[model samples]
Target: ELGLPLEVAVLGVLESGYDARAMSHKGAGGVWQIMPGTAGHYKLRITDKLDERKDLVKSTRAALLFLRELSKQFNGDWDLVLAAYNGGPNYLRKMLDQHKKKTFWEVSQVPGFKSETLEFVPRFHALLHIMKNPGEYLFKIPEMEQAEVFDVVRFSENISFDLLSKYAGIPLEMMEELNPHLKENEALAQVNFYLPKKFGNLVLKKIRKYYAKLRLEKYRKKTLRVVRYRVRKNDTLLGISKKFNVPRGRIKRYNRLRSAHYLRIGQILKIPIYRSVKSRGRVAKKYRRALSRKGAYRVKTGDTLSRIALRHGTTVARLKKVNRLKSSFVKAGVLLTIPSTAKFQPYRVARGDTLTGLARMFGVSVRAIMRANKLRSRHELAAGKTLLIPDQGS
Candidate 1:
């Protein structure tokens, strides 16, 4: 409907091999291999949690609109538009102005034409040619398979796929096969989940059950804070409890960890820290200033105050003094207010210091490093930049 040639869709094939979620090293993503900047220009939503560039139909429509606009800009020269799409229009225009090339064919011989752009038109032409005359090329194309019919189910909260598979009566393998758009073990909130048409009723029924559990009155309270902890190697329930200054029994009850044996590497545990008036009342007025300067810590699977103090450039004595703690005993989900000192320490990022390595070295979680630095997963840690290390559990 965009008044473009049918053969123009071949660019999609060349760009992404028709993979909707295809992403290039240069951050070009989706079926049309649109860069973030181009996707923004076309009004595609791109965020850490959501990327609409991978929506096949929307991306195709956007691609068509962009191609049409480019065609008009190049004065109906589809070849030049295609070339300009491969190389930038501005770069091509500058080359044209410098070399006095009136057409794409003339520009192709010019030195300014990129090597990749030089082959782009020919590749598109070859794809169109092959598609038009498959027999002439001695190629026998396979019939396209029909797409599976599925019903869309939206979840407002993040729920693990294991729970979803069990409750919805869908096999875990089938869920994985159907939801290729989802990352491995992801439980993204407020997203549409595609299920087989037959299981629509089951999915809806389970959705209610799933959400009913989340409607607890305690969860609605603003005073409670939740932290996520991933169990690292050789992590124990006792060690984790001591690190956060909470009871081990409460930790087991909160996370539903029946036994210490159930603890496994990379197992994510939810740590709930209560921040109430009672907890705050324990600290003295003089210590309140220390608490004010302190960073909040949500205990993780294997954290210790020694490690925490080392990471934050503080001492255990100072931590106890600041928090007015009677003992070093901590729980996994308990929030510990670590007092900050006059000597605020910031660690400079060094070469080969990845987030994971730093987390392990500092006895904190990777998420803690991210949270402390206000960073997202895609953010790169440049060497020599100071990163504020949180003095407690993540």
Candidate 2:
């Protein structure tokens, strides 16, 4: 453990009111208000599926290590360390050199010093004082309940958090709250899942039962076929899933893919092909009707023509042609026409489009919709915004 000052723990209260999910407009996140660059420098994982900055245990360790390094740079002067942490260390060092000051108070008087950084140090000290002597400030800190002990269960294969919650007899929301690093409902293989110590053995026993059920199902289902397929150039998991009429999760599970984004060309994969008893005539009719329909898609933040096309199972050329778009650029809130399909449809957020209603209509979970659009909360759903309704199989 780093030999940090006891008062350093109070920094979380000042940074984010001890909220692990807190995010600042400046891109700092989590209780420690760590920026993306700082998290990367400390080797904290930040990926599309996982952000360790929101993990209390990992982020706390990274923050302390960072603070310890800053302490060394400032020669154990916590005041300067705090200043450098708020304002870039390089900026603080430059200010110190220019002003020939050894302390934060002196350098803070310099003209170029930011007001935010200037107040940051004093704000921390004030909070530390108030925390140490709460009675003097007429603040009655409530006693906290005993902390719940957690047990980590590592999985060799990808599993749904929904399934875990059901098996462990824990609420889905509680499971997500306990495991903030998982961006989606499905926990990736090899990742350690933290569960209450009481439910650890129960979860393991249920997982074994689940596997037994899977084996039995496989044996009983005569229509199930295992086909060997080689990964091709420009092949994506989504593309492969679409081609085989399989869910992305199933494809990942069968192949034991750790990261869905990484698929090597020439790699062999075992694809489970479930033969349908229904004739091809019915499917053909459905496909023709789907192609005849036109749908509207509302552009959201970080939308690109290519990405939008991919999500909707179309091409950039087709999207541009349909929308009559002169350029590849698509701005947020812009409505574009798309060819309607059963798998992926676009729906505008109506005045009364509650998160629950939309999820119910799409036959998906609220969390699934939120995860798809990178929405932190249900409140992010606003009227007139376009939302991508994912396929139920997805």
Candidate 3:
């Protein structure tokens, strides 16, 4: 609804190279290079667990909202608005007051305004010019891929990505890649995260099942009480263990801490305290059973062995050995045994399709597609070829 030009979106490309994770030394971040204060004012959450300034869509909306306010403040003087965006509003106001100029062109004569701010308006204009006359300037921008569709999953409290990946039939890495706004390796329960639209419902469905089982298990182990602890300065797992009177190894395993030194200040860690007798073998046995539920997944178009392996938390080599596959390739409609539980579907290749493109479309690796199709590098694939798609495999 803002009156800002639609082309203003391109400004993100110049500011942060269109990288949501881009951060400057002065604390500007995201595609729009929004400062911390501006991010807060625009309601982009920044916390130890999540920094929404690193979120592509949210940050862009925040930037546009900020620009709209600036436009109104500057009385529709886009030059001054752009200048204030580069410098701060205070800087432009000081320049205006010192020079007694009512407009940006007059304020440009002031001494305090930085040289970069002076040229920023012209730079934006030049960008617009170039975009409008790309062929005239002999610029041939390559085609860009369409944006990925997403479905949002909201959490009320913190959840472990490790557990979610295992039971939710999603790859941990894929979840991380889609949700780059996360400050740590895990997702904060306070915010909603996005997954591929195709897999969102599946993941949510699996999460409910996994958590239901977990709640039942917790009820059975009535002696266990879950405690949330925030790490303080110079806190170590060993020190925390001593303070809590729990084994350091148990803490590590419970928290999925890969290393003893992987502690962060202000990061929350879950500590399970036992009120009654200590239970040992049963816990480990239950965990093994939960992780080892095996099933079969049929191959589908664009289905890759590696992707299947990842979804099931197995290695590609393990999957091949289990299926007794001599070659990397498998035809669509063929059923493959999953190391873990999963489902399967089928797809047909269309014209102008590349293996790499297909991999990206389904969020798998190109090499995986190659192996599933028994194709080598530079192998030719025919259009209209049907393929089997595995659900939640690698």
Candidate 4:
């Protein structure tokens, strides 16, 4: 650790109350309230997926190093250093030159200095004093509990915090609390994951077991394939579903479409196709049995005979003939018999499947699979993880 005044630690209290995720209106982030430019200067990563300014250890070290540099610049003047840290060093130096002041106390009386910067140093000192002498301040602090120890585990591949928590038997909330800097559900590769000290070995063992299972399942299991299709002029969801021999609901789900009427021409949709593998026959049998049991569907609002027929893989004529309907219209809460068709299937991802590759192989778009799974990126696809495949033709 860089040797500096013990009082410097209290700056975090004044800055953000030690909240790693604390952000200012000025776009400063983390416990130290580092600005974006400062974070960039310190080489902290800031991306849509990652913002290292919220990383406790990294941000603290950067802040301390920054304080050290400021100390040297102000010639060991802690007051000036604190002032410069609040306002920019260049601004503080400019104020000093204009007012011909040698110390922060002298500069404080000048009108040109920012009020926030002028008050920052004093507020820090006040908090430091109050913390030092709580009895004098009438503050009855509760007895502190022994801090929970943590062990860091480094990963070379991307994995979800959900999986890690499950594997380690740690609560997901606790994991998120411990690692607040992880912005997404999936932790990126080459990052440190902190686990409770007692669960470190257990997490490692479970993760290894998961990887081993993935390797074994790669050659032994059949997975769902994805296909992508672009909407054509005047294309409708029902028409597109019929063309692909997939259900309309599945199309909406895969593409994250909120309504059937919102389709735009040239919009690409992901279509999940069930590939014919040698192992698929057994799965098909089980799937058929399950589908047979689902024989009735209750009519809902906006239900049309054609739409229901398209969803159930039947024709309007077949539905009308079977149900003995006099009209094409149906009311909500009416039960109709449905002939069984293919439903969504769950497929565990294997070692070699890339999102793009899966899209290509199944004739679906990468965006479709991502939308269906609610995945932030393709990187979330890990081996031994199950994905729901939208059913194609029976």
lDDT of 2 by residue, 1-394 (tens): 5888888988999999989889999999888999999999998888888888888878999999999999999999999999999998999999999889989999999897899999999999999889889999998889877776887777778888877777757788877887887888677777767787787788888898888778757743643445345566799988876655657987787666899999764355665645451246554343233223345577899999998989988778877765557899889976566644465556778787788877765556888888778889899988889887675545
Q: Which ten residues in a row have the lowest lDDT in candidate 1?
A: 283-292
**Model 2: colliding residue pairs:** none
Stretches off by above 4 angstroms in model 1 are 143-152, 172-181, 195-202, 213-394
Candidate 3, residue 213: lDDT: 71
Q: Taking the tens digit of each residue's C-alpha lDDT, what string does model 1 give over 85-151?
A: 8887888888888999889889899764689889998898888889878899999878776674776
Error of 4 at 327 (Å): 43
Residue-pair clash count for candidate 4: 8
Candidate 3 residues lying further than 4 Å off, grouped into runs, are 141-148, 223-394
Cα lDDT tens digits, model 4, 93-153, are 9999988999999999997679999899999889999998899988875877767588777
lDDT against the true structure, per candidate, is: 0.70, 0.78, 0.74, 0.76
The residue-level lDDT of candidate 4 at 96 comes to 93
Cα RMSDs, all models: 22.4, 23.0, 23.9, 19.2
Compared with the true structure, the alpha-carbon lDDT of candidate 1 equals 0.70
Worst lDDT run of 10 residues, candidate 4, spans 219-228
Model 4 vs truth, CA RMSD: 19.2
Best-to-worst order by lDDT is 2, 4, 3, 1
